[model samples]
Structures are given as structure tokens and as C-alpha cells.
Target: MVRIVFVALANLLILVRYLLGLPFRLLASRHRPTHVRFRLAGDPPYRERRRAPLRLRLGGSSLEPATVSSLESFQEALGLLAKDPRVKGILLELEGLEIGSAKKDALVKLLTDFRAAGKRVVAWAVSTDSVGYQVMCAADEVLLAPAGRLELVGYAAEATALGEGLARVGIQAHFVRRGAYKTAPELFTHSHVSDIQRQTLEAFLDERYAELVEAISRGRKRSPEEVRALIDAGPYSAQRAVSAGLVDAMCSEADLPARLEPPRPEEKAKAPAESEAEAEAEESLEPMDTWLAALPWAPVKWRPVRRKPRLGLVVLSGMIVPGKGSGGPVGPTTAGADALVKAVRAAGRDKRAKALVLYINSPGGSALASELILEAVQRVARKKPVIAYVDQVCASGGYMAALGAKEIWTAPHAIIGSIGVFAGKFEASGLLERLGVRRTIIARGENAGIFSVSRGFTPHERESLEAEVEETYQAFLGHVAKARGRTKEEIHERAEGRVYSGTRAMTAGLVDRLGGFEDACRHALNLAKVPTEKFELMTYGGGARRRSLLQLLLSMSSTHLYALCPTCWGLAGFKAGEHFDG
Candidate 1:
């Protein structure tokens, strides 16, 4: 009887405790704590036992793909923290972060922003890879699990070749290229890396290695030589990384909360007669980022800066194809000539858009389409600095479009240049003949049957076609020479259809700067005489919506025969930033 009565009293006490905590939840949600906890980690949604419904996402997860709305929501949350004054410091928790270079840049920018707001940033990770360490470098302090792995090993690239296998299977790729080093067609033309491709790859690897060393050095405040030595002996354990000065300390996750800043004194005294429970609830409320969101005003003093309208950011991603529709699944997401031209001209005419940035990620397509867009870009450059940012795959016709920009800035691994031309059609004469099928051609002109797949090119016809392609090649060279401030002869030396990595390309005089989109923006703003604070980035090429699959397929009917690099067309199988590591 005594035990039962005691249990009843305990249940009543539990109910009273829960009821008393109800008001503290609101205080926790609305008030900004002195030390903000930056939950910078995200788990794959699939890992959860009872999967969360889509609506359960407060805004969206960074683990998901970067859609427009998700990106905006992330920026909004970040802005709230940047503008919050009660946030004196931050404790970053990085469980796992998978991101590409562009996203990494954005995260680094966020860290910089929070720091600029006078918040001290600290980070803790269970494990670290090259990417993690890169981001952690932005933090004022970095702590890692004692047993965690620190993967600081350098970069590597590998290429695949399938030419000889195709030939043995009775398929032949009879193609012509203007550049001797254009590696796009090499996979199907040669079983191994050709001498020129090897040369290109070696130079590229050197560039990437150097970039990694420099980045690590800058982050750790170590000399370049020291960083190189450390990276050469990398993939360190957390303890070793700490001993090597790569990390601040080896710490367990539980210790993170204890190390945060002590509460700062309030500017104003609280009202008299406050209950002890209320005071305890307020003090124990912990958050890494400011909870300034949804509040009418900040908890501390802050100024609201209006969004600037200055720089025009025009994205010209995907393949360079003709017509107004995007490409199909079997094809590529095309940058339509009509759409690109419109975007460029619009940026040029917009009075507020003082500078322009052409962010290109394309494996070149239609030569004619590239030329059309190039003309529009050149006009934009005439009015303002058109900084072309080569994201990854910028080759052949893509290079042509980049030439129009006042200066070209390539990402560390950007593939640029292919100042060459290639165009041909496949013939199935042998297969048809072996099957005892014959094709009869009804033609009037001398070149009427030139495009017929039933037969291969005749001797005279082949010679004539070669001459035509040669003329196109010369035209390409002339345009490049004029745009790059080089003579035709000088351009020819580097013209033999060789694609260059950004670092190697700079040495080859193909790109002006080896940096990313941020660098491009800064250069554009500088050239246009615009201050960074006064100007804002306004997107230009987002005027059109993505077309349906049916629309893309139907639009192909409007395309006509034109000069384009077939090697580049096949490279659609290769992702952006993939290079022949040869």
C-alpha cells in the first residue's frame, strides 16, 4: 500500500514538471543564446528507421540536391545568423558533409560571413576527409574524434579507353580532328593515351597537386613546403593530425558542450521576482545559430542591409545546341543559342547590371550555335566586363563562347580550350553488305549522297569534305587569335584540338585566371569599377523554364546539319569535370 502510494505521487510530480516546462519551449525558440551551436552536419534521409515525411523538413536538408528553393532557404537562415548580435560565438558540429567544389565555396563563404559578424567559429568532426579538412580550415578551432580518420591524401584522376575493343567487334570510328591533343576522340581512336594526351594529363596533375598544397597551406597557416611534406605523408589518424598541427585537438563529442563560451552579461537587468525555474530554463537553453528567425526584431543591436543590384550572373550551363528546347535524356541539357543570345543582350542593356559573369559548364556542341552566343557575349563585354567562369567541361565550341568574355576564370579543375573542329557521320556500309541488303540512292547534285549512311565517303568526296573542315578550322583559329590578342600563327601552335586543365591552360595562355565563380565575380566587379558592398548578383539566363521531354524530342526536328565536334558529343557520357587522366 505504501509503495503504490509513492508511485502515484511520482507520476503526479512528473506531470507537474512537464506542465511547468511548456513556457520555456517558446523562450528557447525565440531567444538567441550567447553561444550558437552550428549543426553543420546532415545524415542521408534514407538512413532513418521510420522515414520522415516530406513536410517534416523544416525548410529542407542540405543532404538533398541543391534545388532553387532549398538554396534560398539555406541562405535565409544563414542571413538571420549573420544579422544576429546575441550570437557571440559558434560551435560547429560536422557529422558528415558530402559536397562538391561549388557547394564547398558557399559553405566557406558562410563561415567567413559568421566570422565577419564578430562570432568566433569552432568545429568538431567525427572523421575528416580532404573536403572536410578544407571546410574546417575556415574555422578558428578544429577538434576531431581521437580515433577518427583524417584523410588528407592528395587527388588523383583515372581515364577509360575503349577504342580497340570496338574495332575488334567490327565497329570503326572514322573521325577527323583539328587539334592533335584533343583527347575527347582518343578513347575511341586509341587504346592508350597518345603522347600529346599524356603531356596534357601530366601538366594537369601537377596543377591540381599544387592547388591542393596551396589551399592546405593557406588554411593551416603553414608554409607551402611544410604543407606539401605533410600531405605527402597524409591520411593521418586524428591524434597524428593534432600532433602535426593540422587540428587543434582530439576530443570526444560529449566534451563539445563543456567548451563553449560562458554566458555574456545582459545589457539590461531582468524584472524583479523572477522564479528560479524560469531563470534556470533561460540559462540552460543552448543553440549554435541565432534564433533571430520569425522575430520582429533582433535580440541585440543590428543594422539591416538592403540587397544590392549591380552585377549580372548569367549561367550558360549544359551543351551548346541549336533551337529553343533543352536536350533529351539520350542527348544533353542544351544551352539554346536563341536563349543564350537573349540573356547576354539583356544583361548588356540592363542599366543596373554594371558587370556580367558568364558561368559556363559545357562540352561544346554546334559550332554555329557557339558562334551565335559568342557574338552576343562580345556585345555584352563591350558595355561591361564579361567574366567567363569555366566550371568544368569547357572545350571546342564552349571555348569559342568563352573567347568573347573580357577575361576567363576557370575553376581549379576546369577543362578549357579545344580550339579545334571535328564533324563526321557514321557509315554502316559493311554491316548492310554483310546482311545482303543494298541501298539505292536517287541524287541530283554531286554531294547529294554525301550524308547517306549506306556507304562510306568516296575518295574525291572525302578530300572535298576535309577541305571544308579545314576552312572551318582556319576560321576558328582566326576568331581565337583576334579575341586572345594572339596572331593566327601563334594560336595554331596551341590549336591542335587540345583541351587544357585550367592551371595548364593558363600556362598555355588559354585562360586568364585559375579560380572559381567567386574570383570571377570579384574580377568583374573590379573591372567594372563597382564596389563589392554596393553591388549584388542578379541572375540573367534563368528567364526560361525547363522544357518537357516531349518538347525536347520534338524540337530536334528543327535542327539541321551543322559543324560540331562529334568527340565532344560522345563526351556527354563523361560528367562535367571528367578529364582523360591519361
Candidate 2:
């Protein structure tokens, strides 16, 4: 009882601290209306505060999370740039960093947009490596310290195979997937990339890399071939880089900022303490509003302020499972049929919700679960527009769920399709024999031991399971054909368990359009007949923490959700000590 009391008190204190600290933290973290920073070497004069541009420093390793904060900061800085006419230029310093290529792509786009609008983007690097130089290449003024070096290296990808490694330990992996390109489990099944997968991956990398080269060449005013050659022969000194069109000039490290914008004594003024404190407080406020909230100070709100039609976004991420489940970071497995059915029914009953958008980011799993979700989608589509948006890889069961949508929007790079099904069984009779283990079962049916891994299935059992798999495959094809407005023969050619990227999928008639979430939302509003100018996006859940935590708790305790995927892969690296022969 004492221990329990102590624990409760500690929890209470933590809760209080978090509650109180959040507000202040938010305020402190809020973007200042006017950003002020001192140069590395000197202080600014009082009057210069009015002329100073918002000062920001960028850092990160991949756009994932650690870098997401930096991106948010960049957005805030951009907002300041837009509002404050006094804001002159942005100094984008690229230093030693490990940000992901995806994040780099987004940042490049954002910076490009800013530069296009006549904002100065000056990038400086102390010692430029390949990763750092990639970002520098996007800057209007790529500056290198006279003595600094720039290294450009080619791209490479590495994979660790778990198949043979686990085999020696007596563990057996049974994989059941439909698409030839569903390579998620290849980590466990194959030691190296198959020829087909290799070709696809290479093609994708080539396209992205080429885009990078072109963007850099345009930004630096260099020929694409010349820029490519410079990157190819890298590890060049600052002077050499400037001569090769890789940089605008090589200047002393201390003199670059002064050249960008000479520090004026009048630009260094600070705001009053009281006003600064109040501004900070306002910045710390929570982001609680909806669409208008996202754009708080707009001259005119996109939709009406008082009333707007709400859009229901139903996200189905990860592997599909049965029963009920939430989606996202360590959430429930694929939403069970029942959960999807219930959600769709709720959406239909809610008159305020104008339309529904199904956001999917799954590799597909559990055919039965997919069927349940499909049923819900079908029911929802009959009443209102149900649009499907694919992010990342949505294959096999993922495609199954999308079949009921009136239309589908896939990201340009999104991986979609994989209308195939395979049922797998492990035969461990050899391992059992080696261990001197014998099994005897007495049952009325010859296929009674169908689930036993120690023995191969009887012909009757094999035929039954194969028939079921084929039936499921046919159902998948039929649904896709109807949804896509394609005939059976046309879909059959593309639906034989083959995966296609968003671009390829569009050509194959597997997807209606190539777009992102924003496009899907607009399409949904248009289809639902909600005046495009007056609809609201209504997210179903709370903040990510509450939503994700609740989902994890629910998934672990829910007996109905039994997905073989995420479950098997997560445990693959661990020693289950289960011996088998495949």
C-alpha cells in the first residue's frame, strides 16, 4: 500500500509538471514575430532590430523526426519572411549532417519556392561532404571557405538478410504474400535483391538522383552535364569547386555573412522586455484550431469561420488484421473488418461529415481482414464519395481494401498494387525426425493434421487451401476491375501479384490519379459536392501521443486482431527456438 501510494504521488507530480511545463514550453518554443540573432563574432546596435531578418540555423539527419523539428522551424522562419518586409535574406548554412534524402527533397522544394519569390538563399559549408553538398547545391549562393573541401559521392543501399542467419538456429519462416514486388519479407526469405526488385529500385533511385542533378545545375547556373561531372570528380578544394561551377566563390569563413548582408548598427535593436515576454507567451499557445487554426492570421479564411462541412479521414496503416484496431506508430494491426464497418457506419450517420477519405500506407496482410474493410468501404461509397489515397507501399490486402473506393489517388512515388494471394505451410517432419520426436494423431478426417508442421498436408487439405487462395485472388481481381473501370482481361494482366509504383500503376489503370493527401482531400470535397471553399478537415482522434498509446494498448489486449505480418517480422530476429524444415 505504501509503495502504491508513493508511485501514485510520483505520477501525480509528473502529470502536474507536464501540464504546467507544456504551456511555458510552448510559449518559449513559439516562433517569435521578429527573429533576432547575433553574428558569431560581434553584437548588433539597438536600431538594427527593425532591419534584421529572422535568424535560423538548420540541422538534422533524415527528415524523419529529429529533422522534423528543424523543418517546422524553417516553415516558421518562412512565415516570418512573408510577414516582415524588413526581413531581407535567409542564410542557409549546410554543415555536417545526416538528414534523410526524403527530407532533403522536401527542404529543397521549400527553399526553391522561397527563392523563386525573390528571397535570397545563401548556403555556406565549412567542410562539404556529399550529404552536405547536396543541400548546398540548392542555394542561390553556394559559398565555400577558401580552405574548405567539398566531397560528392555516389548513392548506395545496403540490406541485411535474416534467412540463413535464422536457419542455423532452427527457426522457420513461413511467408504468405501475393505481389512479386512485395519485398518487405525478402529480408527473411532471400539473401540478396532479386533481379526484378533490383531493376525497380535502381530505376527509382536513378530518377530521383537525376532530379537532384538537374535542380542543382539550374540553381548554380551550370550545365547539367558539367554539374554531373563535378559531382563525379569530387573531394575538390574550395577554389577548385568554384572553378568547376560547384560553388559561386570561395571566401574567408568570417567574411561570407558580411558579404550577404553587411551588419548595420541600427538592425540590432531588441524589443521591450514586457512586449518580448508577451510575444513569447502567445507563441507558446497550443495549436488547437482546425483549418483556420492552421492558417490563423489569413486575410480571409478558406472556409466560413462559423460553419463548414467536415471531411472524415479514415486512415488504414500497417498490416490488416481482424476486429478493431487503430493505425499508426505501433498501433493496431490493419483495421479489422468490424472496426472499419463501424467507423463507416458512424460516418454515414453523421450528417455533418460531407465525405470520406481512406488514407492507406500498408504492405497488406490478412485477407479476411481486408474483406471486412472492403465491405465497410463499399457501404460508405454507396452513400457518399469514398476516395482512397495511397502513401508508401499499399499492396496485396492493401489493394483489396481500396477496391471499394470510387476513386484512388496515389503519391507519385507511392508503391501500389499486388492483387495476388499465397497460402503457405511449413513442413517440419525432417526436423522432428532429427530430434527423435514422433507425433500420432487420430481424427475422423484425413486432413485433421492440416495445421501440424511436423507433417506435410494431405492432398485433400492442399487442394482445399489452394482453392480458397485462388478464390480470394479472383475476388481481388474482380473488385479492382470494377473500381478501376477496367475489364477482367485488362486487370488480369496487371493483377497477377505484381506490384507497381504510383507512376506505373497509373499507366496500368490500377490508380485513378497520382497525388498526395492534399489532392485526395480536395477530390473528396469535390466529389461529395461540398462547396470546395467551405469544407473542414475533421480528424477522428486526439494528438498523436494519446492516439498512438491508446491504439497500442488496445491492439495488445484485443484477441481478434491476429496479423501474421508485423507479428512475425518483429519476432523474426529473436530466438523463438521453434525448429522446422522448409
lDDT of each: 0.65, 0.58
**On residues 1-582, what C-alpha lDDT tens digit does candidate 1 reach at each position?**
666667667667766655565566456555546555655553211111111111243774344222222333444555666666655666666666654454455667777787877777887788866666777888889899888878887665456565677556544444555666656556655787677655655665576567667767877899999998998787789889999999999877655644564323551244435434444555432542325432333343211233354777777766677766453444346678888888788888888888888877676767788899899999888888889887566788888898899988876566777777665555556666667888888888777777776665667666766777678788889888998889999989988776666667899888888775556677898888877643456666543334453553333222122333334333222222334322
Model 1: how far is 471 from its true place, Å? 1.6
Q: Highest lDDT, which number?
A: 1
Clashes of each: 6, 16
Off by over 4 Å in 1: 1-31, 37-88, 92-119, 124-129, 143-153, 217-289, 293-308, 325-332, 349-352, 382-385, 391-393, 411-413, 429-444, 501-509, 512-532, 543-582
Question: What TM-score number comes out for model 2?
Answer: 0.65
Could you tell me every candidate's TM-score relative to the true structure?
0.69, 0.65
Off by over 4 Å in 2: 1-80, 90-110, 122-138, 141-167, 171-193, 226-261, 265-305, 325-341, 428-438, 541-582
Clashing pairs for predicted structure model 1, backbone only: 36-288, 37-287, 37-288, 179-496, 179-497, 180-496
